[model samples]
Target chain A: MIRAALFATAALALPTHAAAQETPNMPAATSPSPGVWIPRMQARAYLLENDQTLLEQDLRIEHGLARDLSMWAELPLYEGFLDAPRPSDGEFGLGALEAGIELRVLQHDLDAIDTVRGAVFAGAALPTATDGFGRQSLDPFVGAAITAIFGRHGVNAAARYTFVTGDTDLPLFIGDDGEDVIGADLGYAFRLAPAAYGEERVAAWYLTLELNGAFTAEGDREVLFAPGLLVEAPTYAVELGVQLPIAQEGSDRPEIDLGIFAGLRLLY
Target chain B: MRHPILIGACLCAAHLLAPSCTSTASTPTAVTMSYSAEPLAAGEHELEVHGMSCPKCVSNVDLQLKRLPGVDAAVVDMKRGVVTITLSGNARPSARDLATAVSDAGFTLRAIDRGAQGGTP
Candidate 1:
């Protein structure tokens, strides 16, 4: 059952929830390259009650290199507390550097309805962390994502699989929860503001919900439901969300009672 | 420990300062003047779109429309929420196809006006 879910998500290849589209009434998880450069800094913190805290600061840049192709790079600083009972043994270091390219696969327009968009992407994560905080070796991943919009409602789906290459015998870290990992997310976004469109730079708000899951080859699976609010201006956006674990099984990984994500994105 | 803080500070400063440096280009006066009233070429169609609230939304529309198989060019008018699409030689898409592309980009197709040059038969 875990493998099946993994495969299903791997096939979808959805975009990260942090990369919402700038357009109103669009899905928040599908990355859209609007023929321009987009630079985003995302700060994420995860807290496990009585367990650990994970802090991530990522510098991400994406550009539409061509009409149908876009490339992106992400540099992250990760700070997290592992399973150590001592309070001071937590680790902080540069996390994996990731780079990827996405190709628009399908885009179609309906006569009286909204449009549909699809894309496929492939990327690699390079080990750059200290003290086993990241995958100690290079990890490659590929996935597909699709989005559909209808007036003020939109839905997005994505699946991806990462081929892990880390020292399995090393001491475990919170980031080392898996060997091969499959991840997927299903999200819906509803426009909350801007009952009517405007000509100048418009500020729109959206209420979003996402079902996200990660499946590991080691039989560990973690699933969460996240509800968020997104605000978009002309060239920037701010998003805030909370993730609550719905199901967790297998592996000794401690369940996160609650997690929060706040992000800011900019386009140029 | 200080890296995240430093970066955050710098980003915050940039975000606050960018408006002063680049506000003129996106001003309402500038946006209204950008509406294209140019004539469409043969096999061209114009889509009066809805719900495109910003320049980024216009870009999204352009990106998705140009991804269609037969499309050669897509121009989005942010001022009017209009998109002009041109088809390649001997290629065409139905109204449904156009609507689907716009919808996929998270916009509505309010109207499709055939180009004055000629319609695809």
Candidate 2:
């Protein structure tokens, strides 16, 4: 689950998540290099627009379907929104469910060419997390991005626009669908520790700057900005960071939200 | 000022320019081995140290030992949890240096076996 606090999303704000931690989340749907394939459990907390926050933990399975493809399925083990009305007194309800796939179109080994390969990616976010917290019936989004790598530096720029049916059976919640969403990211990573044994893992530490904006199909606009960090090891990795909303328009929602995310993947 | 394109471009430029400053010449790794100041006997020594977990760990230990001023090569079979370091010419790393490198890598060297010692070969 993309936890609320981890992503720093406000309760009332739209979904403006952080950088592409996954290669599927990589530069794009093109040429991706062989990266670490990690499987583990993760948890994150989201700060919504209403000053309310929701934290979720999930058993997540993220597999690098291919150099340019990643498949992930997350099942919620628990969920709690700090500011939103509690769904129940105890942990008994269908939580927001989600599953998705990310595709990379281009990428290359910077080590060989010394030039980081560029890439593009397209993917969809499914409404798989249960509707317990804020999971709507359907949330289908499409996005594209490009990434460039320098020796120990790089940037991944992505734009994602999700078209929601604006049809959550629930009324108070307006799904992000119909809200043309766009996210652009800039990130850099340096090798804190060089891979001397086995094969070299890509960059060791990565920091990302991300900005996302959404203009409703109806001409309403809202934007969000987020940044985060990541550390990679041979068979495992650790990451931590926060997201803050920078600009907002055409909405009654607050202009800012906050969240935190962290996880590691074991490369096969 | 959200200039990912500009930022990406600059980064691409830096990545391209960095190697030029270092010298178009690739770093040449010299494969010459020298024995340490102190030479070891043809036999073995029982030495206790740290840092040896998996096969990869063994590789690092081997890399460290083989570069010994006097030692020639080292082999670590992680499954067996043993490392065999051998040298022919002269110069040998002090037991302290060997133990330190192993410990720094997060492993312990329980013993060093030459032929006479009973440690794992």
Candidate 3:
């Protein structure tokens, strides 16, 4: 399923849309504080087998509707090779449009420097891609995320499942079988700069590590290990990371050899 | 695939149906009405804010407080969860106003203590 891989590559950009004070490659239970609006952009390149490469640029926006409610929308543009075997030069077009809402279910402020939060989110992707680059059907998904922060160390985890409603005709290992998809991710962040907080408004630096896994209904599975660095200020953030395949099994498409991403975020 | 979706849906439904479970325990009650009618004197005021754990969180509080008219400066001590605000001369922001700003920033104002006029706490 070259189409599946294309969509999956776009989906990988979703985690970079995290709210304020979150790692770059994982879903965090935290949202923008109430009345805040965040705009984000990310560029990603995936190096696949057969000398093929997929490039994606994603633009997203997030808004805090209330103390416990937040929403986000994302649109991606893709340009690169789709057929691993054929290895044509490439095509460029828009990908699916995705939107989701998150509701914080549990939040506990243990103290001034420690807190824990949990949230559940649901959303759907509209088949808005240019011809031959998308699933061409509405796909619904659901997920849960958690965040725990203890001083300079933070942990975030999330899991999601998407219902694939499109049709795939390519043979197994080269194309998707139209089966649903499941994904799970875990991330850790350590503040590397500004050993302590003070009165001045100083930019903070963070080192992050994430483990991302995806599985298809037909047993195709892939896991990636990503490490990143982030610099965050009061109203903006910059981040960059690299992803390497740690394990892959029962895949039905071209394997990803490497992925690199860079992103920026601004809050208003 | 279907199983995971079903479980996630059920969990979402369970959480949505239970408002109490989703509410934060430290959500501040309506205490603004208890604030004195008199505006805080022109001076530095120390406020103990809750639910701030990161630099961005601190910045949120800082920005909201500085948005209030008459606030000369807002200094934060993150480790102590304290924000010291200095009011300019002729500035007459009420306690309720300060509390509302903090609330709007998604934090709780646990307590406020006024310092000497025109001086740091």
Candidate 4:
């Protein structure tokens, strides 16, 4: 009886290799992974009403703090034709500093070929204008974003609400009332090159179209359409885009007709 | 400074064709593609994972697996989507516990293979 008991104990102690079981498809995970920082710089040129123009640049950095949490910050510089017909003598100064944190709430791997990701974020824009560039008030905002990926094609939709807090009586183009902004980005990635299994790197090219719309509590509204291209690798990506205003309301305010943007992001 | 449109156009055209024009040396190398395993411990396990598409995903699994209580080391192979985990001496976690860790890292564990002595290569 003691020998039989010892045999049973040995049998149970043997290694157990679990067989492969079919798992239900889960949601898609983010590409950059967690614990990485991506820093990007964007420059824009805007064609405003009355043949005036605005040139703006932004340096943005984002970090994935955890699997479902991330943070970001941005510094903006602005140059605009404050005086008519003197494009060379326009006001050039710093605009605003913005920061935010995001928490991913849902991610679903629909199948082998599809994924969905969603997140919500809260942000603040601090008044850091040098002279004639930005609003002189603190603005806090909340936003949500969702991305659906189908193999190489993807779509991103985001909406943000800003609560304006200071100097609401400024010019319409600079400061209005609290506003709502909505945007959508659609992209398709082409594997221009493939990396071997043991190779250290890979590359992909993408074409994207973005539609941005904004509405202010004071009845101001506008829409912009942008088309862009992107080339991304493991640690770096470059993007260029052109924005054209497709719709607008409130004629007395300065309006942007066309704009261009180019940016690069570096990961570490 | 003078003609923003011309500069922008030139920059865009150059960037669009740069990837195809340049070789791999110019592209950023993949990060965290390989893992160096530590010396084997007593309670080691190997998992066959699925749905890892890039090196970044490998890193994600690595981070999560290392967070487990008894996990001493975790190595992930992006190409094979395999994960090998080592637990400290006298520390043993069930196969289901490991499967849950992989799942929490947004991956699927297809199979769990344990060694005779609870250590897997």
Candidate 5:
């Protein structure tokens, strides 16, 4: 009876937030809070292509909406690495931006836990990444994810589906200019090294190594992998790494697209 | 940074078949187009370059290679301990310099197979 009441309250309070399909990135439904700290903002980018030499860039921002949930938007910036008089040298345009949220279903710090830790997430992403960048029109999507940390080992898995409704532009990656969008992210992170966290003057410091591989539901049937290190402090963290595009997906041109990037993730 | 929540779901299907992925006993799976067990080659050595054990090491290696002259695109086959280079216009590599680059990036140059004889650019 209480669960039904809670559902009713949620339905009336947040109707649009309800996801059509559950993605691993999206956690189970939950309430919202201002968060232990203020919401944070992050910027990250990626350069991708096939062996054919095609190119694409991704610029994105992610922010936490609550303690266990964070919202994000991504824009597939700068494509056409092969275009023109150095087409690769061009201005920044609208990249595919997605407005979605991620929830942390489970959170625990166990001393004897080794590396066994599991957390779940799921949310909705409105195709806000941008229609101008050849991205799809306004569409709604959903996804879910579960990740665990065991000993020095870390593992995660997730899936998502984007339903097609409004105008259709057949987004890139997918072979068709169709009416739907599908995406998934899976990988792992190992705490190869550990650093300190928080101080009297600061929150903390943390250092660790990681590895990850991901593919999407669209034309990108690729097994993209990256390994790198991260330095985390109380207020923020920095991650440096590169992408190795060893696999190709769909009609996506095949080219050796490589990139070196740094990212800022803060919990402000 | 946080361990990406996406990786687990993406490789879940495969992990079911190869549960030994992170174990010392784990064997490198089919990573090359030719599908060879002893995949590492000479010009480049990739002997299960352990120690990294994370996604970031993959990125670090890519960064280390781009700085090389002859190396056009250095694609690291993470799960396979292989690094494939797309050389440009007869870009020759000095084994000593190549080894240093790999070592500085924090990995072992198990082997380098001049990459496939022919595949698109």
Candidate 6:
């Protein structure tokens, strides 16, 4: 089955570079190039399956400290069936707490409508969750990301590795073998509205497609294709997307049939 | 299995329905004046900044410039990529300071004019 903690961690792993510049399922390496200090808040919900329904709500906050540095944290609350047809009432509680920092290593503004950037990030997941929801250990992770923007088209890619510290006897999802986890994602976003840039502030709409993959040291692999829509203003954004598993190989847990997510982000 | 075609159709529908939500105008013309590294005088100053394509970009430049000492206000003409800064009395912020502020906001300061009147110098 889908482990609530693992799902939550994967969903909230990366920090956004700008107010609404990131894709829904992946991180953007671009820094907050247009703001000195921008703080952002996002509330996201996900619905997925193992053999039963899994619903999770994630709250995230990010702050840009400088032109090339940013930090973020996330907390998740989950409600779902922990097992197949067991615990008929279902279970509800908090998941792991994760925090991270990203530093832009390279940024080149090619012109008014084109740019490239790269960043590296590191953080840890703290074991602060209700029973049957957390790893009960501190997990450290590191990753790098890159972004490129040309006119109305943008690309983002990131890869991360997380080192699981402890093991549990509970019917865990992935990483129960104390093996590390690896994840990678690539996303493309195309501006669908305001086909061109102008003087006045306008709400921007984007169509995004992404490929997200996860692998474990114990030969578990899963790859999902996610397509999403985003409506972004200067101060806030609304996003909705759905994920479909295209590949599931050697997975020790239940296969994920489908996943849906929606989120709202506010910038200050 | 999930219906990929259905999801794609929904996304397309959403985009098509929102065609009139935002303007589709092209980029505005920008001032192309050159600036010298001379000392800035107290009063109003205009700066030509580069790589500002959105309102948020203008806001960032405005906020950073206003944070500088003696800067009373900063107004951005996004179409022209020019920022007009009002300086308080006795404010002697140099051209380098203005450039630095723009750089800190993730853009480049291309030119600066000391007075409100436009001239080629």
Q: In order, what lDDT does every prediction score?
A: 0.61, 0.43, 0.73, 0.54, 0.40, 0.65
TM-score of chain B of 1: 0.57
Across A1-268, the per-residue lDDT of candidate 5 in tens digits comes to 3432342233223111111011112222222221212222222233544322223333344444543456655544443334333234333345445666654443332222222222233333344534324444454555555544444455556565555444324334442243354554555545433321111222122222223333434444545455555554333445556656656555433334664444454332
Query: Candidate 6's residue-wise lDDT over B73-99, tens digit each?
Result: 887765566788888755557677777
DockQ ranking, best first? 3, 6, 1, 4, 2, 5
lDDT, candidate 5, B1-121, per-residue tens = 1112334543464345234323311111111122332212324333224333233444455666667676667655433455666655444455445554554443444344435452111
**TM-score computed on alpha carbons, candidate 2:** 0.50
**Per-residue accuracy of model 4 over A1-268 as CA lDDT, tens digit each:** 3432343333233221110010001111132335656554566677777677777766566676765567888787666664443323555577779898876665554443245666666677898855556466777766666666555565666676666665443343523443433333333333233332232435445666667767665556777777777665544555667888888875245778888765554433
**For each candidate, what is chain B's TM-score?**
0.57, 0.49, 0.70, 0.55, 0.49, 0.61
Fnat for every candidate: 0.06, 0.00, 0.48, 0.03, 0.00, 0.21
DockQ of 5: 0.01
Put down candidate 3 lDDT per residue, A1-268, tens digits, no spaces. 4763555455444443334447676678877656777776777778877777777787788888876788999888777675744324566677779999987777666666677888888898888866545556677788889988888888889998777777434322211456677889999989887887776777788898999988876777889999999888766677889999998776445688999887765544
Give residue B78's error in model 5 in angstroms: 32
Model 6: lDDT to the true structure? 0.65
Stretches of candidate 2 off by over 4 Å are A1-42, A49-51, A58-60, A64-70, A74-78, A82-103, A110-129, A169-180, A190-203, A219-222, A249-256, A264-268, B1-121
Mind giving the per-residue lDDT tens digits that candidate 1 earns over A25-95?
A: 21222444445566666565567656666666666677766544678888876666655632224455777
Q: Candidate 1 or 2, higher lDDT?
A: 1
- Prediction-by-prediction clash tally: 22, 78, 3, 6, 80, 0
Q: Residue A185's C-alpha lDDT in candidate 4?
A: 32
Q: Give model 1's TM-score for chain A to 2 decimal places.
A: 0.80
Among the numbered candidates, top TM-score falls to 3
| Local accuracy of candidate 1 as per-residue lDDT tens digits, B65-86 | 7777678888766555668778
DockQ of each: 0.06, 0.02, 0.44, 0.05, 0.01, 0.12
* Global fold similarity of model 5 (TM-score): 0.45
lDDT of 3 by residue, B1-121 (tens): 6646676766777666567643453244354445555678888788877768666777788878888888999988887888988997676688888877876676667668834354211
